[model samples]
Target: MNKLWIVLTYAVFTVLLIIPLVKMTTAAFSGGLGALGDALSRPEALHAFMMTALVVVTVTLLNTLLGMMTAVYLVRGNWMSRWLRRLMNSLVDLPYAVSPVIGGLMIVLLLGPGSAAGAFFDHIGFKIVYAFPGMVIATLFVTFPLMVREVMPVLQEIGTQQEEAASTLGAYSWTTFWKVTWPSIRWAVIYGVVLTIARALGEFGAVLVVSGNIINRTQTATTLIYQDVENFNVTSANGAALVLAAFSIGLMLLMEWAKKRRGVH
Candidate 1:
């Protein structure tokens, strides 16, 4: 009976996930590798890849570094009020609850041409909306919570006992962190960063809302795929989508590997 249930679950998962993935894989390779290369080698497609790389790299770096700091503070900082801590914890989940398109709309409201911030940036020769900066901001907003959530649990599990021990032994704050805390949280940080890379790579709705999807300027790979599909360039779209799907799979595998290495269930 147990084996029967396991088999049933596997069959269900295969039907829901494996079938569609196989279909996409077949479509992506329909024209063969050479055709895929040709599609991606186009100038617009290449520029879109470059733009996406820029956004993913920037977002990953900022989120990983800032997220580590935030998790450390949230877990270890002594807050005078419990409500303030609860509020901060809730804010970390904001991106999960808020729609990505709404996130983009919020950015536009804050930085669009009609706003004072937008005017000041324009006067200073900076562009935000419909540009590279806007894409980065959108991606960052959507992916921000991943790192914090991943590292926060690890921080809480490890606790401040070791850090306090190191400080009592006369180690400086930076020394304590480098020698004690970092070793434990490194795996969680790597997991967070891998997830961030995956999320930033495939972001579409938020970026689309702000990017204007200019051909060689602000278009990321996801937007380029959307445009290609709208123009009925299915081959090009498939190629780009295949690349992103491969990236996501690779990052997911990395995350699983990290989890295994850390002996996480």
Candidate 2:
């Protein structure tokens, strides 16, 4: 009896989520393989998917490194890194509180080519806030806190004493990290990276503002899907959306592998 109620609750929630997914897939395959093939082969769709993949890769690298450094500083630094810790931690909450569009707008306010600092960049042939650079920056701003948040708590749980012990034993910085610190935090780092990749690939609002929605150029997969839907090309939109969904699923699988690796170690 109790098991039945629990099953019912989950079944209801599962249906809620699966229904939309079913609709999306239905839209994708309603016209069969021919439509799917056409959507996949479209140059614009291919370009958007490739651009999204590149952004995911870039964001993962940059955020993982910076977030690791930030995590280490928060845990081990001596000179009132506490204040900086507070600041960094506070920014972690921005993704939840601030809208992505607002984040993109903030970037434009500082980096738009029309601004003075932006003029200097323009003079140097570095365009921002309406190009690829701007799109990446916007994605970074929105995805910035994910890696830190994922890893910091794990770092805190591991404590700094292991690092201290390694230092006392004359282990070099890199060696100490690989030997002592990384073992415990590595899974968290991997999870963070996967999450950031997902976020960067799916990031729409922030990129929309900064990318100028430039099709076949600055159009990311998410934005391309948006344009397709808006233009009443539901089939194309679903096809592009499925590509993003596949990307998201791939990262999630990577995260599962990382989790297993963590368990093994």
* Candidate 1 global lDDT: 0.91
Which ranges of candidate 2 are over 4 A from the true structure?
1-8
Candidate lDDT values, in order: 0.91, 0.84
lDDT of 2 by residue, 1-265 (tens): 9999999998998798677778888999888989998987899999888888888888778888887887777667767566886886786778768999998888888888768988899999988878878887888888878877888888889887888899999998999999998988877887888888888888999999988888888888998998998899999999888777877888788888878877777
Candidate 1 lDDT tens digits, 13-120: 999978877876787778988887899999999999999999999999999998898888788878636677778888988999999999999999999898999999
Residue pairs in collision within model 2: none
Model 1, poorest ten-residue lDDT window? 77-86
lDDT of 1 at 196: 94
TM-score of each predicted structure versus truth: 0.93, 0.92
Model 1 segments more than 4 A misplaced: 1-8
Against the true structure, candidate 2 reaches a TM-score of: 0.92
Q: Highest TM-score, which number?
A: 1
